[model samples]
Target chain A: MNLLSIVLYPLISSLLIRMWGGKNPKLAGWLGCVSIVLSFVVTVKVGLHFFINSSLEPISHNLLTWAILPSHAILFSLKMDVLSFVMSLLITGVGLLIHIYSLGYMKKKEYGRYFSYLNLFIALMLLLVLSDQLLMMFIGWEGVGFCSFLLIGFHFESHKNMNAAKKAFVVNRIGDLGIFLAMMIILAVLVQEKQLWSLAFEDIRTHLDLFLTKSIFGMSLATVLCLLLFIGVCGKSAQLPLYIWLPDAMAGPTPVSALIHAASMVTAGIYLMCRLSFLFDVSHFASEVVMWVGIITALFGSTVAIFQRDIKKVLAFSTVSQLGYMTLACGVGAYAVAMFHVVVHGAFKALLFLCAGAVIKASQGNQDVYQMGGLYKDLPWTHAMFWVGALSLSGFFPFAGFFSKDLILSHVHEHHLFVFVLAMIGVLLTSFYIFRLLYLVFYSGKKRDLPGYITPWVMKAPMIVLAFLAIALGFLWTPSFLGSIDLFPQWMSSLYMIPFSTHSLWFEIGLSLLALLFSAVGLIAARKLFVHGPIADQWIKEKFPKLYQLLLHQYYIEEFYYKTFVHDGPPSNRKLSQDTAFTNSLFHFISVIKGMFDRYVIDGLVHWFAWIPQFLGSIYARIQDGQIQTYIRWITMASLIVLFYWFLWVSGMIA
Target chain B: MNQLFCLESYLVISSFLFVIGLIIVLTKNNAIQIIIGIELIFNAAALNFVAFSYFRPHVTEGMQLSGQIFAIFVIVIAAADACAALAIILSLFRVFKTTRIQNINRLRG
Candidate 1:
C-alpha cells in the first residue's frame, strides 16, 4: 500500500529466511509464502483504493529518489492508474496463488534459494506493473528476466536447466534490445527539440507529436519504431521467431513455469503494448503489421501446442498461443479486450500449469501423455481443476476465456477479416490441442494407476480459487463496464460502438452458441479418438508424420537460429577463448576498408593538390643557406646605401 | 626582467617536452615511465593554464574555473591512476615480473 511495502517485501522475505535459517528448506518456504501473502494484501488494499477512485485520484507514492543529475532526477516511484491497478491486482492476487502453490509443489525439495528467487520475482513483477516511468519499468523488466533466469535454472545442479536458462535470457535480450531501441528513439526525438528525457508516462505522451508525426527514409519514423518495438514484444510475449525459449523454459519448477511462463513474464510484452498504445495510434501501418503477425503466431502456436508430448510444454505453448490472442486484441484497436484476455488467461493458464504441476509431482515427474493416463481416478481435484482450466482455455461459454477471446475474434472480424479467419482457425487449433491434452492425460478410458498421494487441502485451495476466478470473471465483465464507456468502431465513428441493446443479444445468442459448438466438437473428437481409440497417439505420430514432426520439433526454428546467429556468430568468449589480441575484428575490417577509400578516393584529390607544394618544400629544405657569407654581402650593400642617405639628411630620412 | 622573458623559448621548450612525453606514453615498455609521461602531459596542460591565467585576469571564469578545476582534477586523477596502475602492475608482477608491458603476455592464449 505504501512505499515501504515495496522495499520491505524482499527485505523481510530475506530476513525471514535468515531468521528461519536452516539447511532444511521448509522454513524458508513458509517465510516466502508469508512475505508474498503480506505483500499481496498490501498491494490489494492499494489497488482497491486506486481502482475505486481511478479518475480523480491517481495513486502514486514517491518511494525514493536514487539519483539526481543537474538536468534530470531519477525518482523511483510507484504510480497506479486503471492499467496498473489491473496489472497489480492480477500480479499480487495470482502471484500469491502461485507462491502458495509452490509450498506444496516444492514441499520435499530444498527451496530456500528457490523461494528467494521467487520472492524477488514477486517483488520485481510488482515494481514492473506499479511503476510510472519507463526506466523503472525496464529495471523491473530486466529484474524479472534475471529472476526468470535464476528460477528457470532453479535446478542448477542440472546442466540442462542451466543451458535452458541461458537460452531464455539470450532470447529475452532480443526483446530487451527493442525496449532499449524504443527508449533511444524517444531520446533522439527529445534531443531534436531540446526536451529533457522526462521518462514519466504523461510527459513522454505530451511530447508524442515530436516523435510520431515525423517522417524518415520515405516512411513514417513512428511506424518504423513501433514495428521495431513489436519485435521486442514478440520476443517477450513468445510470439513467432523468438518463441523457442518459452517451450524450453519448462526446465524450471512447475510453479516457475506457471508464474513466469504462463502468467507474469510472458504478459510483460502485452503490458508494454498497452502502456505504449499512444505510439501505436500514430503508427497505423505498424498496427496492421502487428495484427497480421499476431494472427499468424496465434495459429502457429496452437498448431505446435497440439503436438507437444510433455505436459508442461503443452501448457507453455498454450500460453504462447493465448498470448498471441492478447497481442491480436491489442493489434485490432481493442485495449480493454486485450486486458480482459490478459487477466482471464493469466488466471486459467496459470491454473492449468499449476494443476499440471500437481499431476506431474503425483506422477513422480512423468510428463508424457502416453505415460500419464486416467489421472482422474486418483487425483479428482487436480483432474477436475485441470478440466476447468482446459475448458476455459478452449473458449467454453460463460468461462472468462470465452468472453475475452470472443472480443479478439470480434475485433479482428470488424477490422481485419483475414485476421479474423486466421484467428478462427487458431481457435479450432486451440480447442483441438487443449481437449487432446485433457483427454490423453485425464479423461482417457483407461485409468492411470498412481500411488495414493492425497494432496493436502492447501494445494486444492488455490486450484479451486483460480478455477472460480477463471469461470466467474466472465460474468464480472457483466455488460456494466461496457455501459458508460464507448468502444470506438474500427475506422468508423464512436457512435457506431456505443453500448447498443443488441450487444448482449449477439454475445449470448451468436457468440455463445459458437463457443458451445466449439467446446462440444473439441470434447467429442478428443474423447472419441483418445479415450476410445487404441492407436490415437500412434496415429498422430505416424499418420501425420511431417506435420507432427514439425510441430514437435518447433518447426526447427532453433536450428535456424543456430545456423544464422549462434554457430557462425561472433563466438561468445564464454563459449570460446577471450582473445586479448583481437577485439571487434569485424569493426576493424570495416574501418580498414573505409580507410582505404578515404585515402585513395576522398583525400586523394586533396593530396593531389598538396603534392606540388610538398615537392617544393622538400627541395627548399635541401637548399637551406647555412653559411654567413651571402648574408654579410647583402648587409654591406644595405649599409653603403644607408651611409649615402645619412650624408644628405640622416635623421630626416630615418624619420 | 621583461627583456629576459622570451615567451617563444618557453613555448618551444614545453612543446619539446610534451612531444617526448607523448612518445614515452606511446612507445615505452616501462609502465612507470608511461605514468611519468602522463604526468608530463598534465604539467604541460597546467603550464598553459597558468600562462593564460597570468595573461588574462578579468576573463569571466574561463581560465579561472577550468584552470583550477583541471589542476585539481589532474592531481586527483594522477593519484587515483597511480594506485590503479600499481594494482595492475602488482598483479602483473605476480604473473610476469620486470614492469615491462611486453612481458605482460600471460593474458594471451
Candidate 2:
C-alpha cells in the first residue's frame, strides 16, 4: 500500500459516494466505512514497517511537484515519521469508529451526503497529519476547517445550525491568519538570510539556526513566528478567547461532534505544535504565552462546563477544556506528553461523544440532562460505555486520562507552581463536571420510560472497542515511577529531542497521587451534589444565587463578546434607556445626534455618489428612444458637419 | 463625352438622390420605405463611382475599370442587403401587425 493511498482512498470514496451512492444510503455508508478501513490498514502497515525496521528515517514519498519557483519547488509530499504516524493513527482509528457510529446515528435520507462529508473530513485530517511540508499541512488544515463547517451545518434546514457552523468557521479563520503570517515570515526571513525558500519540515529544521540570528520588530524572529503559529493553535484548539465556537459547534450532529469537534480536527492545533516543537523549544517567551493561555483556558472551559445542562454542550466544553490541557502540556515544553494526552484524549473523548450520541438517539433527540434521568436502565450498553469514558476523563486510576493528565500536571509543577495549582483546580473541575453529567444523565431522578428505543449493535460495537481503548491506552505512556514500559515517548523521542521527565521517582509518584486525590475530591463532590437528585443543587442555587447565575451564564463572556463586537451599539445604551428621567432624556439627545450624523454624513455621501450615475444615466436614457427617424436625423446632421470640415481641410482653408 | 454623362452632372444628380434618400429614411414611418431609401442611397454611390471612372483624365493602365467593378460589387451587396432587411421587416410586421418603424421600437434601451 502506498502512503498516498492513506489520504487518497477516502477522498476518492467521498466523491464516488456523493455521485453514485444517492440511491442506496446503506451502500454509501458501507462504502465510506470500507474506504476508511482501507486507509487505516495502510496506516497500520506503515506503523508495522517502522517497528520491524527500527529505523529513525521517516517513510516519505513525493506525490507531485505543486509549484516551481526560482529558489525552490513546493512538493506535495507525505511523511510518516514518529509524530505523523501517531497522529494519523489516532485520526484514522477514531475516524473509522465515528464513521461507523454515524451509520447508525444519522438519518437514512442524509446518509450519502453525511458519509461523504465524513469521508472528506478523514481524508483532509489524514493529509493534515501526514504532509511533509508546511504548505501541504495548511491545505489540509483549511480543508478540514471547510469540512467541519459543512458537517456542522449539515442540518442546513435550521438557521441556528448554520449560524453555529459560520461561527466556528469565522473563528477558525482568525486563527488561520496567524499560520499564514507565520509562513510568510518564515519564507521572507529564509529568503533574505540564506536564499532558501523551502517550507518542508526537514528543510526548516536544518535551517533553524538561521532564524535564531534574525530579529523581527526587536524581538527574536523565532519568538514572533511561534507566537503567531500559536494564535492558529489557539483558534483550532479552541483556547480561552476563541473557544466560544466549540460549544456552539455542538449544533452539528452528535457523531460529527464526536469525530470532528471532539476527536480529530480540533487536535490539529496540538499536532502542529508538536510537529514544530523545535521552534517552540527555542522561544521561551512564546512558550510562556502558550502556557498561560492554555492553563487559563483549561480553567475557563471546565468552570463553564459545570453549569451547562445540554449533554452535548457539556461534552463540547469538556473537549475544549481537555484541548486546553494538551496545549498546556505543549506550553510547558512537554510535546510528547501533549501528544500522549492527545492519543488518550482521542480514545476517551470520542468514546464519550459516541456514548452521548447513543443516549441522545435513545432519548429521541432530547439533549438536556435536566430532562433525562435514570437512563442507565434503558441504555445499558451506552451507560456502560459512558462510565468508561467518564472514568477516563476524570483521570481515575487505571484509566487513559490519569496517566496523561498526571504527566501534564507534573510538567506544569516543574515549570511554575502557580500554574500548577491552577491546573490542579482545572483537573478537579474536569472530574466534577464530567461526573456531574454522568450522574445527572444516568442516576438522578426517576427512570425514563423510553418506548421502542434500542441501542443498535453497530453503535455498541464502536463504543465497546473505544471503551477498551480508554481503559488500556494509558499504558502506552506510564510514568517512570510506575516501572513500566513508556512506549509513547520512546516512540516519539526521535521527533521530540527533549527528555520526557527528569524528576525523581518519588516526586513523580507524589504528583500522581496528588492528581489522583484532586480527582477523587471532585468525584465525591459531584456524587454528593448531583447523584441524589436536585436537593443539593437547589440549596447551592438558593445560597449563592448570583454565583450560580454567573456560572450558568458562562461568566457572560459570550454576551459581552456579542455586545462589544457584534452588536450595533453599546450595551450600556440599552440600560441607559431605562434609567432615570434625566438619563432617558440624555439618551434621546445622543440618539438624535447620532441619527443626524448617520443620515447626513454617511447616507448623504452614499446618496450623492449614487446620484451621479443616476443623473448621467437619465441624460443618456433620452438619446436611446429607439426611433429610427430621430437616429437617422442625428446621423445626417453629424455627417453634414463632418463633410464641411473635410471640404475646408481639402481646400487648406482651415490651416 | 456627352453633357448628360459628364462628371459634374452625375455628381449633382447623385447628391440629389442622397439627400432624397436621407430625408425618406429620417421622416418615413413605414419599415419598407426605410429599406427603399437605403437602396436609393446605394444606387447613388454606385452611380458616382461609374461616372468618375468614365470621366477620369489620366487613368492608369490595368486600373481604369476598378471604379466600375466597385460599382457592380456595391449593387450586388445592395441586393442582398434588401433581401435581409425585407425579411426582418416581414417578421416585424408579423409580430406587431404593422410595418411602421415607430411601432417596432422594442429595441429601446
Candidate 3:
C-alpha cells in the first residue's frame, strides 16, 4: 500500500489541487507539500522494510496486462527493489523539501498552477523510479520531461522562460527518440527473431544471448541498443551537445532549479544506464563512449561553471558537472557507486539550490554573484547552509559528496588512468568554481545595504534539513579506515548484476585524502582569486582572452547549432536548397488541391444547399405581407379553390 | 328538426352565411371587422354541425350527442380566440394607431 501510494498519492494531489486549490494559493501550496510529505513517509517506510529484510526478493506489483498476441504481453507494473527503494527515498524526501521551499519561493500570481506542476513532477519522478517495465518507465520518463517543460515555463509571461523550457523539452525529446528507437529495435528483435516478447527487465536480461546474436548493419544489436540508450542518457543527464539547456533552465524559479534541474530529473539518464547495467556491461565499445562522454561533459560543465556570472547558472553548470560524475561512475561499471552519488548528490544539490534561493530572495531577486557579496552576515542561517552544501558539493571531508565521490574516484583509478586524470581535472574545476561562487556571493567585497527581506521559515526549514543531510548522509557508507560501515553500497549490491569490487583500506584512504587535498587547493585558490575582488578575474580575462571568452560563451555551441540546423545547414551545401525546393513544391501542390477542394467542391456544395432554402424562403416570405385583409383573402381563396376541386371530384369531372 | 325544415334549406342558409362572411373578411379593412367575419364563418359551421347531428340517423348514440358536444367545444374555443384576437388588435392599435388591415404590414418579410 505504501509503495503504491508513493506513486499514486502525488498524482491524486495534483489533480485535486488543480480542481479546487486555484482559489486559495496558500491551501494549494500546503496541499502540494502535504502530498509529497505523505509520499515521503511511504518511501521511508518501504525503504526501511527493504533495508531490514536484506534477503527479500524484488517484489513486482502487476497492475494490468495488455496482451497483444497469444505469445506476447505488456504489463503495466511497479517494482520495489533495493535500487528503486533508494531512488524513491531520495525523490520523495527531497521532493517534499523542495515543495515546502516552493511555498516561500513562488510568487503570488497563479501559484496554484506552480504547485500543480510541482506535484505532477513528483508523481512522475516516483513513477519513473518505481516502474517495473521499461515501457512503463518510459511513460514516467516522458511524463517527467513534460512536467519539467511546464514548470520551467511556469512564468510563461516571460519569453526567456518559455524559450528555455522549449529548449529543454526539445533536447529531451531528442534523447527520448533514442530510447524510443532502442525500444523499437529491441521489441522488433524479440518479437520477430526470438519469438518471445516482453519488456520486463527480467525478460530482457534473460534473453541476452538472442540480442547478442542479432546484428544490425553488421554491429551486434546489443551494442547498438546500448549506444542508442547512451545517446538518451547524454540528453537527459546534460552531457556534451545536450548540456546547453540545463544552464538556461535557471530561467525557471529557484526551487524548480533545485528539484528538477539539479537533483532528481536530470539524474534520470544515469538511473536508466544503471537500470540497464547488465546490457552496458556486455558492450565494451558502448562503455568506452559513455566514459568519454561523461569525462568531456564533466570538463565542459565545470569550465563553463567557472565563468558563470548568474548565481543559479553557476549552480546549474555545477549540477551538469556533478551529473557527469555520476554518469562517469556508471561508465566505469560502478553502478552502485553511481546510484550512491545520485542519492547523496540529490541531498546536497537541493540544499545548495535552496540556499541559493534564500540568497536570491534576500538579495531582492538579484541573481548575479558579482552584484551580491558580503551576504554572510546579512543571511547568517542561509550562509551556514550554503557553506554545508558547497562543502559537500566540493567533496570536502566528512560531507556526503566526499564519500560517494571518493568511491567513484577509486573505481575510476582502478579501471583507467587517463579517464581518472580527466575526472580529477573535472573534480578540481568543480571545487574551484563552486567555492568561487560561494566566495563571490557570500564572503567577498563590500557589503551592500540590502533591504530587510526575512527568509521565511518555510524556505529555511528545508535548507536546515538538507544541510544536516549534506553533513551526515555520507556516514551511511564510509571508507574502511573510517570504520568501514559501507551500508549504502552493500544495500545496493543486490540490484546490479556485477557488484562493486571492494578496494583495500589503504587505497580508499589515499584516494579520500587526495580528494580532500584537491578540494582544499580549489577552495584556497578560489579565495585568493575572488575574495580580494577583481585582480585574478581581470588578470585571467586579459591573459587568456580567447579562452575566457570561449568558456564565458559556452564555447559558442548554441550558435554553432543555430548556424548548422536552424539557418538551413551550411552555405556551402547547395543541395540543401534543391532538396527543400522539391519538398516545398510537393507541399505546395498538395495545398493547392486542398484549397481548391475547400473553396469549390466542399464550399460549393454547402452554398448550393443553402441557396435552396433561401430561394424557397423568399417565395414563401412574399405571401406573408402581415396584412390581416390579405391573409383573410388568401384563406378565403384557398377555401374556394378546395371547394371547387371537391365539386369537380363529386361530379366525376376530374380523376 | 329534419321534418320541420328540409336539409337543403339548412345547407343553403349556412352556405350563404359562409359566403357572406368570406366576402366581408376579404373586403374588411378594420381588424375588428375581420375578426367578426371569422366568427360569422365559425357560427355557420356550428349551425351545420347541429343540423347534421339532428338529420343523421346514428351520429349521437342515444344520449352521447357527440356532434352537440363538439359544437359546444368549438363555441368555447371561438370565445377564447375572439378575446385573444381583440387583445392583439388593442396592442396593434397602441403601436400603429390605426386598425386598417392594409396599413398593418409591419411583419412583411
Candidate 4:
C-alpha cells in the first residue's frame, strides 16, 4: 500500500534466493510466489478502492530537502488512480501467475537465483507504476530495466543469452537517454515560464502550454521532448528499428519472456504513451509519426513471426507486433483503444507464451515447428487451451482480441481509410500467421512424440486460468461492470479518457464472424499444404523466395547494425594492436615536436631572455664567486653594460 | 525560493571542500589518500548545507536534512568503496609487499 511494502515485496524475494536453506528449488519457488501473492493482494486492495472511487488520498510531503536549498525538495509522493491501479494489477496479478509457472518452468539448475531475479523484477515494476514523481518513476523505470537485463541473462553461463540481455539493456539505455533528456527539457521549460522546476506530472501538465510556447536553441522544444520520450518508448516497446533485441530475448526462461515481453516491460512503452497522451494530443505531427511507426512495426513483426521456427520466438515477434497495435492506437488519437489493446494483448500474449512453454516441455524442448506435428492427441487439454489463446490472438469473434483489435481498426478508419487499410492488413496478417503457427505445431495431423513431464500439475493450472481470462474479458464490455464504479462514473473506468462502447452489438458480432472466417481459412490452407509432407514447405520457399527470406531474417535490421555499428566498431578484429599502436605513435609524435621546441625554438627564446638576467647575474656574482678569475670576468662584463646604458642615455640614443 | 539562492551563495565553503577532495583524488598515489579525498568532499557537502541553514533562517530544514542525508550516502558508499579498495590493497600486498600504485602493474602486460 505504501513505498515500504511496495519495495519490500521484491527485497524479500531477493532474500529468499539466498535463503535456499540447502538448495531446495521448490521451497525457493514457493517463498518467491508467497511474497508476490501478498504484494498482489495489497496492491489489489488499493486498486479496488482506486477504481471504485477515483481518489487515492495522495500522501504529500518532502521526504528530504536539499541541504543548501530547501525549495529544491525531494518529496516522497504516492497516489493511486485507474491507470496505475490497472498497471498494479498487471504487475502483481500477472506477476503472481508467472511466479507460479516458474516453479515448473525453472526446475532446472539454480532456480533460487532465477526466482529471486523474477521477484526483484516484479517489485521494480510496481515502483515504476506506483511512484508519484517523474524522478521516482525514473528510478523505478531504470530499476526494472536493470532487472530485465538480469532476468534475461539469468543463464549467463551461455554466451548468446548473455549478449542478448546486454543488447536489450543497451538499447533500453539509449531510450532512457531520451527520457532523461525530456525531463531536463521539461525542467528547463517549467523554470523559464514559472521560475520554478517541478517533476510532478500534475504540476508539469499545468505548465504544458507555457512549455510549448518556449524555444530551445531555436527548436520547438516541446516537439523535441515528446519525440525524445517516444524514443524511450520505441526502445522498450520494440517499435521499428529498435525491436531487434526482443525476439532474441527468447533465450531467457519462457516465464521471463512471458513476464517481460508479454505482460509488463514491453507494455511500459504503451503505458508511457498513454500517460503522456495529453502532451501528444498537442502535437499532430508527432502523433502521425507514432501512428506510422505502429503500422510498420505491426506489419513487420507479423510477417517475421510467420516464418519463425522456435515456438516462443514466434510469440516473441507477435508481442512486438501487438505492442505496435497499442502504439498505433496512441498514434490515431485513440488512447483508450491503445490501453484496451494493452489489456487484451497482455492476457492473450501471456497465455500464448505459457502455453508455448508447456508444449515445449511436452515435446522435450523441441520448439521448432518442423519437429512438432499433431501433438493434439497427447496433450489435449494443452491443445484446447492453446486454441483459446491462439484464437483470441487471431481476433476471433466473441474473444478478447476481437473487441480490442477491431476497435483500433475502426478508430483508424474514422481517422483515415489508408491507415485503416494498413491496420486491416495487420489484422489479416496476424490472423493468418498465428493460425499458421497453430496448425504447423499442433494440427498438422502427423503423429508426434511427447514427453511425460507435461503432465505435471504445476504446468497446467496457470494455463487454465489464463485461458479463462482470454475467453471472458470480451464479455466485460457488455454493460454490467461499467455501472459498478460509483466514484468513477464512466464506462470502463480507466485512467485514460476514451469511450467504453465504441461500436454496436452488430459490429461486434460481425467482426467476430469475420475473424473466425479468417482463422478457419488460414487453418484450412495450412492443413491442406503442410499436414502431409515437406512439399508445402518447399513450395512456399519456391513461390515466395525474397519475401520468405526477408521475413526469415527479420528484414535484415540486424544486418544493418552489424555492418554499420558492431563489426566496424572493432575493425578487422585488431583492437588491442591498433589501440596500442595508435597511442604510442601519437604520444611519440608529440614528444618529437616537444624535442624540436626544446632544442631550437624554446632554447633560443630562453637564451635571449636569459641574456639580460645573465649580465645582471654576472655583476652580482662578482660580489661572491667560486673562483676569483670568474668573478673578475663577470665584473668586467657588468661594468661594460653599465657604461653602454649611461652612454645611450647621455647621447640621447635613448630617444 | 529567495532564501534558497542565498543559501547557495553561502555554500561556497562546501564547494571548496569538494574541490580539495577532487585534487586529493587526482594527485594522491596512495589509496588511503584517495579515500581521505572522498571524505573531504563529503565534509564539504555537509558544511555547505549547514551554511545554507544559517543563511535561510525561515527555511528550518534546509541545511539539517541534506547534511544528514548526504552524510549517510557518503558513509554508505564510502564503506562499500573502501572494502573494494582494501581488497585491491590486500592483493597488492600479497604480490609486492607494498601499496605503491606505480608497482601495481601486474594487471598489465
Q: Would you list the C-alpha lDDT of every candidate in the order shown?
A: 0.75, 0.88, 0.85, 0.74
Judged by DockQ relative to the true structure, which candidate is superior, 1 or 4?
Answer: 1
- Between prediction 2 and prediction 4, which has the larger TM-score? 2
Model 1 pairs whose backbones collide:
none
Q: On lDDT, who's better, 2 or 4? A: 2
DockQ rank order: 2, 3, 1, 4
Per-residue CA lDDT of candidate 3, range B9-105, in tens?
8888888888888888888888899888888888889888877876786554565576687789879988999999999999999999999978877
**In model 2, what lDDT does residue A477 have?**
81
> Which numbered prediction scores highest in lDDT against the true structure?
2
Candidate 3, chain A: TM-score against the reference? 0.86
Q: For candidate 1, write residues A1-655 as lDDT tens digits.
A: 4745854686568656645634758778777878777877776677566436633255788876765565655567788666776777787778788878877888555567777788788788878888888888888899999999988998899888898899999999998898788777776676567556556666667787776667777677778778777888988899887888999899999988988898878898888888877777667788887777787788878888877788888888888888888888878767667777888898999899888988898898888877777788788899899888988998887687877776676667778767777887778778888888887888676766687888777678889999999997766554333342322121112111222233444554565566567667877777778774235767877888887788877787765565444533332223332332233355456678999999999899899888989998887754434422233345656876887888758567554
Runs in model 3 lying further than 4 Å from the true structure: A69-72, A568-655, B1-109
RMSD vs true structure, all candidates: 17.3, 7.6, 8.9, 22.9
Q: What is candidate 2's local distance difference test score?
A: 0.88
Kindly list the per-residue Cα lDDT of model 2 for residues B1-109, writing each as its tens digit.
5767678999999989988888888888888898888888998899899989988999899999998999999999999999999999888889999998788778776
Ranking by lDDT: 2, 3, 1, 4
lDDT of 2 by residue, A1-655 (tens): 3889999999999999999888889889889999999999999998887789887689888888855664475667888898888888898999898888888888888998999999999999999999988998999999999999999999999988898899899999999999999999887777777777668888788999877888879889899999999999989999988888899899999989988998889999999999999999999999999999999889988998998889999999899899999999999999999999999999999999999998898888999888888988888888989989999998998999999999899888889999999999999999999999999999997678898688888898999999999989999888876766788877888888776568888888888898899999998999888986656667868999998888877787776655544433323346623334543455567788999999999999999999999999999877778886877778889999999999999999997
For the candidates in turn, chain A alone yields TM-scores of: 0.82, 0.89, 0.86, 0.82
Candidate 2 positional error at A246, Å: 0.3
Q: Which ten residues in a row have the lowest lDDT in candidate 3 chain A?
A: A563-572
* Model 2 lDDT at residue B61: 92
Q: What value does DockQ give for candidate 1? A: 0.01
- The top-ranked prediction according to TM-score is 2
